[model samples]
Target: MNMNVAERQGDCHSQLLSSHNARDLLNSVDAFLFDCDGVIWKGDTLIDGVSQTLDMLRSKGKKLVFVTNNSTKSRRQYAKKFQSLGISVSEDEIFCSSFAAAMFLKVNNFPREKKVYVIGEEGILEELQLAGFTGLGGPEDGKKTVQLKPNCLFEHDKTVGAVVVGLDQYINYYKLQYGTLCIRENLGCLFIATNQDAVGHMTDLQEWPGAGCMVAAICGSTQKEPIVVGKPSTFLMDFLQQKFQISCSKMCMVGDRLDTDVLFGKNAGCKTLLVFSGVTSHSTLHDPSNSIEPDYCTNKLSDILELLGP
Candidate 1:
């Protein structure tokens, strides 16, 4: 029988792996999409029992994909991090917003002769290069300052075709000015945002300003919205579906954030699991004003094994 909206909410509210049919739920999904920063590791630290749980899942023949909205690291860099943490993740198994941004440009047939103006770090630049695109302005322009004197002339590259914005630790007036000119003045210059997450775990201690801050700066100056290529956009989901040839119904998304991770899975028509080891708390999930809900809730990812194992 079909349950009403209230009943459904009630059911989901009580659907923690500890009390639910976890073994059946785990058996139903062929693949799992994981959000990295909070769900897998906080900063450089790995979550407890994560390695054992992942090994158990692999033993059961389940595929795993690490889908992260962090644009600060390329797939190769992510793989290295995984290795350093003793997690057996491959480069192809990782999907980051940096790679998504580059893939968006490539699949859209961006002009090869033109350059991409970067507002982020080496991650975006590396992905752009790997995608056969030249990237300009990043750490190289971090120390550059603008002269506010009267009649000061600022010369920006005319060959710039698109301005890609991500999480830039060294965000400054010069880079923003350059990006604004390209988008506002350059004909047909595309503005692309890796992700618009409001906050991120830049460190394990606290949340910091995310890529949205940088994207918003360019958006305000250009008076234009960017093509978001990360989670909640379904771009990465589409890419993953094609690359993995997996059906959305047979996949489960596990993450820590409701706005991005859970919402992304819901948008992509997959089962969603919310965990509390990251940015969100249990009270935040049950707040009266909160609308987004996942199919399941757990204290941590390792609960899949601890709660379900015999």
Candidate 2:
């Protein structure tokens, strides 16, 4: 998931910034957090200026962290994709909702004996696996989603540890109720969420509530707070700051979404760069309903390179 920062283009100077200006900002940053979907790639195609911006930043000795609200793929998967796009990145430089979740699990003593009862796609499953944990699927009681079904968490696997919540295209009332009950029983099995995005239904106007909805169900039902492993949370920023040794002040968060990316940067007290390559557009900037604002806005990532003053 990415945050939207509505665009209001600045008047960039006609002349490119000197090496000093470029390095000045580079020197000011301690870390850099970027959203992957709109700012970097849309589908399998990489956006313009992404490679050059990254290269320029890298050449300036800036530390970069690719932050995405997407929890569907593992770090390895992301790294491979970036490599395929001819962009150089390491798994260490990537952080997703799943990464935050794995860190939370390890910090809390999960998978030692607790198994996750997953309610999301395979991405969360892979994340749990890398964290030295195993999970089970909900009971196949001949239940079909997008319609009707009975509660299933009661049918939790004997080795179930926590109820893992991810993205589910075919969610139904039964899944929600069952998941709520699982947390209620105090199996001590926790509720872990990959990412709590409101844009789960981007492909469809229905705007289906994502795992965050399920998380709300569990929290409402059991009054138990599940750890959120995504942007807008300080964990991802902390991870970047710690891993990259970038000073928080010199860092910037860049993304197309305002809620996830820009808000996330604001929370971390870092500079924010909003791009309109995807998801969000300039119209959103003037809309009061959109309760977010970024420090900078650009039509494309390339504009950032364009704005570097001498």
Model 2, position 111, has a per-residue lDDT of 54
Per-residue lDDT over 1-310 for candidate 1, one digit per residue giving the tens place of the 0 to 100 score = 8656555445345367663567877889999999998899988889898998899999989999999999999999999999999988999999999999999999999999999999999999999999999999988899999999999999999999999999999999999999999999999999999999988889888899999999999999999999999887899988888889999999999999998999999998999999898999977787655788888888898989897765
* Model 1 TM-score relative to the real fold: 0.95
Query: What TM-score do all the candidates reach, one by one?
Result: 0.95, 0.78
Q: What residue pairs are clashing in model 1? A: none
- CA RMSD per model (angstroms): 3.2, 6.2
lDDT of each: 0.91, 0.70
- Number of colliding residue pairs in model 1: 0
Over 70-113, each residue of candidate 2 has an lDDT whose tens digit, in order, gives: 76677988899899999999999988776677777787767577
The C-alpha stretches of model 1 lying farther than 4 A from their native spots are 1-14
| Residue 6's lDDT in candidate 2 | 33
Give lDDT: candidate 1, residue 282: 78
Residue 130, model 1, lDDT: 98
